[model samples]
Target: MSDSPENDSIDYGNLMHDALRLLIRNVLTDVSENGLPGDHHFFITFDTNHPDARLADWLNDRYPGEMTVVVQHWFENLDVGDDGFSITLNFGDQPEPLFIPWDSLVTFVDPSVEFGLRFEHHSDDDDDHDPDPENDEIPEAPMEENAEDDTPHEAEVVSLDAFRK
Candidate 1:
């Protein structure tokens, strides 16, 4: 047998990434069929510049690189598919449609349950470059309960690094 670089062997990283993205898809699919259960809400962050991502021109211009969206309180027409999902969200009472591909997701969080996932984008050319720390940060979910409650709950984010060997 010929020797090969570990990275060239079984790619657990990509496997895990795909699995997590599927999890998000499944969750969204459920929510699309039946509205968010209890106080469960999501804070989804995605790369606005991703080629597959579709958003309003003004939104792209305002957010530039990345934007975080709240999937609670006032979203409409949530449609989940095998590869991505689309939904209409309100921005200052202006409803705009957004199509976010699963691959463009940077982070997904449900602070009510204190659960989250962070995805790291890897590319052949990115092998030598360090990951952007900013992308690692999961945005805090919007208040899903009484505004008087100021307690903060930390999310248990599942990072692939923990499973890497």
Candidate 2:
């Protein structure tokens, strides 16, 4: 673990993080082209005020910290790209569109498949950022649920501490 030139040459962790972000983009791209399969749905949590995050002024005002949205049903205009994705979801019976960059995503989870990814963001506004609590920004009211769903929604929390040094 010397501070030699070879050891300090490049940042491997950053490369891995970038690669995972690509994976997320790829997954979203695929889901966009060929509709989501099975009981699969996504719970995406991201920083609302991130520079790359795009949404209405009211949205930013409402959710200034962390905001989570369900991509189960009633999502429209899902545009996925290399940098990020934008989609329209219902917010209290109104169509709300949100564009979020990969770097701003705090967590992506598919509870049905028990698959999830948690990201630790290094942002300029980390003064009061509290991403430790799962579903920290969940809406107070219940969102539109599946018509055939008898089971209640459940969240599977996963830790990313092991990946951090």
Candidate 3:
């Protein structure tokens, strides 16, 4: 067998990203089918500028870049699809529906269990800067207080730096 680097090169980064996204999808699907079990909740951060991300005009205006949503107490009509998920959440007592694509996701965290996954943001137009492991810290999103409790939750994020080259 010929040992060519090109022939043996596999896109592990993309593969891992896809697998983690599938995990998110599966979790969302389970939540949609059977509701969040135990004290489990999710802190989902996504790109608001993504083409497939749908939110109210006011929300878009308010959070033009990225937004983190807590899927805990006040959520409804959760629908999980192959490519994405849709759910209704309240904003100042006004319920609004949002559709967030899996590809648009930046991070997924379940602070109750201290489990988290952070994804690298790739832009087609961004070709100048290379991936920097040092700058890979997950960005904090504005979190709403849980209705049932006043205590704050912090996610223990898992960095994907070691797997990168």
Candidate 4:
């Protein structure tokens, strides 16, 4: 057998994915603790099934496995502690609370500047976790939320169509 270090592989891709998640979490933590400074908003999508996820009964019912949250206008009580973040978001004219730990997060998208990151599913076992029961191919959640608060979801959903020009 040939001796090659490449044969004993390292998953640099997964490592990078984990690092990106931490970076996203840090940004969210900063924004939550201190108001997002001039023209900064985020689009965060996460798996609802990961053990650390928290959502309203209705939201959990609608999106049992995953959901995307807009960190723009109308969000309140933005608090980020050691484990995760807790914020109040409006759902169909009614405000609901949500809490999401970093681990539950499966993807993060910052449409503000044409950037996005997708994470491995719970099944990937990047860090020793059992596979989630939910189906992995379920469609992604919508990019926006229906809420009365004006938190600036706009920054998270600008026109990429401009790039086509």
Candidate 1 regions exceeding 4 Å error are 1-8, 122-136, 139-165
Q: After the best TM-score superposition of candidate 4, give how far the Cα of residue 117 lies from its true spot, in angstroms.
A: 0.8
Q: Which ten residues in a row have the lowest lDDT in candidate 2?
A: 145-154
Query: Once model 2 is optimally superposed onto the true structure by TM-score, how far is the C-alpha of residue 150 displaced, in angstroms?
Result: 41
TM-score of 4: 0.64
lDDT per residue for candidate 2 within 45-163, as digits (tens), equals 77675778898898766666767788887888999977789999998899988899887776776766756665654344556556565544333222222122122122224643322
Q: How many clashing pairs in candidate 1?
A: 0
Collision pairs in model 2? none
> TM-score of predicted model 3?
0.75
Whose TM-score is greatest here?
3
TM-score to native of every candidate shown: 0.74, 0.69, 0.75, 0.64
Q: Give the Cα lDDT of each candidate.
A: 0.72, 0.68, 0.73, 0.61
Give the higher-lDDT candidate: 1 or 2.
Answer: 1
Q: Any runs in candidate 4 off by more than 4 Å, and if so which?
A: 1-14, 122-165
Q: Residues 67-131, candidate 3, lDDT per residue (tens digit)?
A: 88889988999999987999999888999999999877767988777677866544444475344
- Rate residue 142 of model 4 by lDDT: 59
RMSD (Cα, Å) for all candidates, in order, is 10.2, 10.6, 9.7, 10.4
The TM-score that candidate 1 achieves is 0.74
Please report, as a residue range, the 10-residue window in candidate 4 with the lowest summed lDDT.
Answer: 148-157
lDDT of 3: 0.73
